[model samples]
Target: MLLGMRDDEEMGRITLAQVAERAGVSISTVSKVLNGRQDVAAPTRVKVERLLEAHAYRRTTRSAREAPLIEIVFHELESIWAMELIRGVENVAKAHNAGVVLTESGTRHAPGPEWMEAMLQRRPLGVVLVFSTLPTEVKQQLRSRSIPFVIIDPAGDPDPDVPSVGSANWNGGLAATRHLIEHGHRRIGIVTGPEDMLCSRARLDGYRSAMTMAGLEVDPDLILFGDFHVEGGYDRATEMLSRPHPPTAIFAGSDLQALGVLEAARAHGLRVPQDLSVVGYDDVSIARWASPALTTVHQPLRRMAEEATQMLMRLRAEEPVSTRLELATSLIVRKSTASAPTGSPAGRGGARS
Candidate 1:
């Protein structure tokens, strides 16, 4: 039994008074730590956290004044997929008659301390994060307040400790590469996302697998890391096209980067699909609007967000939810890709610049 627990008290319920007494602190101090007040010293916070963890403390009741709001935090609000994710969260929040609060805070890893403090003050019904991982302190703060959170991780890498939703990044990469191979692209180049992200690595591995399966040589020089943006795509594509034996097809990894590839091809006086076939990932809204459309991988971004929001609701209701959910990705073929050009270099077992 806990030091301050009475025999008549509930088995798992620990009151603030009991926790305060055990920690040798006043009730107000405990309250400050619970509310994520910055005034609390680091040592005091750590001590309180340890005590709370040991006792398995959980806030059983929410204040009546707390608004019916669901908060969605993003590292970058300007991302192309942000609107789709926001719409998904809004759809679920509307069904529950709850307002959706959107905040752009923190890095790709976790929300910052300022965001955590403000979130505790708001005391939303639940939270939806567009990050792969959360700091231990952030996780503890949310759990201590009984604030459920779910991550919509597009990176295909999820934190083992939390519930997350992602898509099949490896499958998407394999599908994209195979599609190019089917179009007779023997010498294919890939501009995958950043090197540090697992999704990028997974996709690159998938590309490699497809190439090996197709009896194609995986040239190191044909592979480039991109920032998943237009400029990165353009720069990488331009460099590849400049090579003596340029690839017949280029998988730009992202729709925005694919757009860059198209721009680079145009600047080099190369016609898309005719001179250089292009493929992209993430069939976003602008994919179909592109000049020749984009042959890309369709990542279920909105569905992932919707599922993450639903998981939050399940968590709030004390219902069972999967720790991780990975959705399937499909190839969306459009006008941008075609058979490798003939007579130039494709027929000669090489690629044209």
Candidate 2:
């Protein structure tokens, strides 16, 4: 048996000295790699990581000096749902007496390498990521250190190997569209999120499904993909409103986009509900305070975050957890949506053949 090494039934009996020898590196180098030190050469780190993984190595020891922290990383901190997610993580972290660390880095796909290096060094209790996917190396490094992670994937797309928390995006979309249809709006338009995101596609599919079920002819021109931002919403709404026979109602994929649609309607001299009804998704705070309070789908952002943080704790405890947890989405009706205008092309009686 090697010094400071003990047999772990689950982690297997791999000693640090054995790993160092196989990787052609000193035991100290292997230790640095395990601790996520950036001073080691790239080749050496990769070799050590492979050996550790091959040996099914797990770091069972915890440093007494380590801080109790729960880290949450996001690609964009400016998102409207960011505060809700933060609040959720904070709620759980506070309960466990662990501090929460927020980091904004990387793209929609994954966090940056620098962030990874820093995170490994910090050695937080676990991690909660808002990204849809994580790189394989990042996953391996975290596993090698026995660090747990859960993805708060609002995009509704997550890597197969990683655990995740997401809402019913497709159901949200369907509910939003069905609400419009029930209000006698037949010529409805949809402005969903970016085409590349699975969440966007899922919502769009929901919209299509609702329209089909209502016996409404879905005009391809009325469907637009947005950036889930006010600008994209405004631009898309403007394009759709300018058409010869525009939609009598529009469903903006997000609250931010809904605000843009409201502005677009105002610019076109259309009275909401009376002239053109509007609906939005993700009932963020702004949705309620809009000129005509938005009728939107209440995506449980905070709850999703809470569940994700809880999952991280479960993982840390080596408890069995579901690979994917999907929560339900409900619609909140307000002043923005109403019956279609009597004079509109697809008014109350305008069910498509």
True lDDT of residue 274, candidate 2: 77
RMSD of each: 3.8, 4.1
Candidate 2 global TM-score: 0.92
Per-residue lDDT value at 151 in model 1: 91
Question: Per-model C-alpha lDDT, please?
Answer: 0.87, 0.88
RMSD of candidate 2 to the truth, in angstroms, is 4.1
- Model 1 TM-score, 2 decimals: 0.90
Write the residue-wise lDDT of candidate 2 on 1-353 in tens digits: 11123457544557788898888889999999887888999999888889887777877676665679999999999999899999999999999999999999998788988888888889898899999889987787777677889999999889888999999999999999999899888889999999989999999999999999989888999999999999999999999888777889999989999999998888888888778888999999999999999999999999999999999888776677899999999999999999878764743332211
In angstroms, how far off is 286's CA in candidate 2?
1.0
Q: Estimate each model's TM-score.
A: 0.90, 0.92
Per-residue accuracy of model 1 over 1-353 as CA lDDT, tens digit each: 11222432567667788989988888888888887777988988788888877766777666675679999999999899999899999989998999999999988788877888888888898999999888887887787777889999998788899999999999999999999899888889999999999999989999999999999999999999999999999999999888877888899879999999999888888888888889899899999999889999999888888899899888877778999999999999999999988876533332234
Residue 76, candidate 2: Cα error in Å is: 1.0
Q: Give the best candidate by lDDT.
A: 2
- Prediction 2 global C-alpha lDDT: 0.88
lDDT of 1 at 157: 81
Q: After superposition, how far is residue 318 of candidate 1 from its true place, in Å?
A: 1.4
Error of 2 at 307 (Å): 0.1
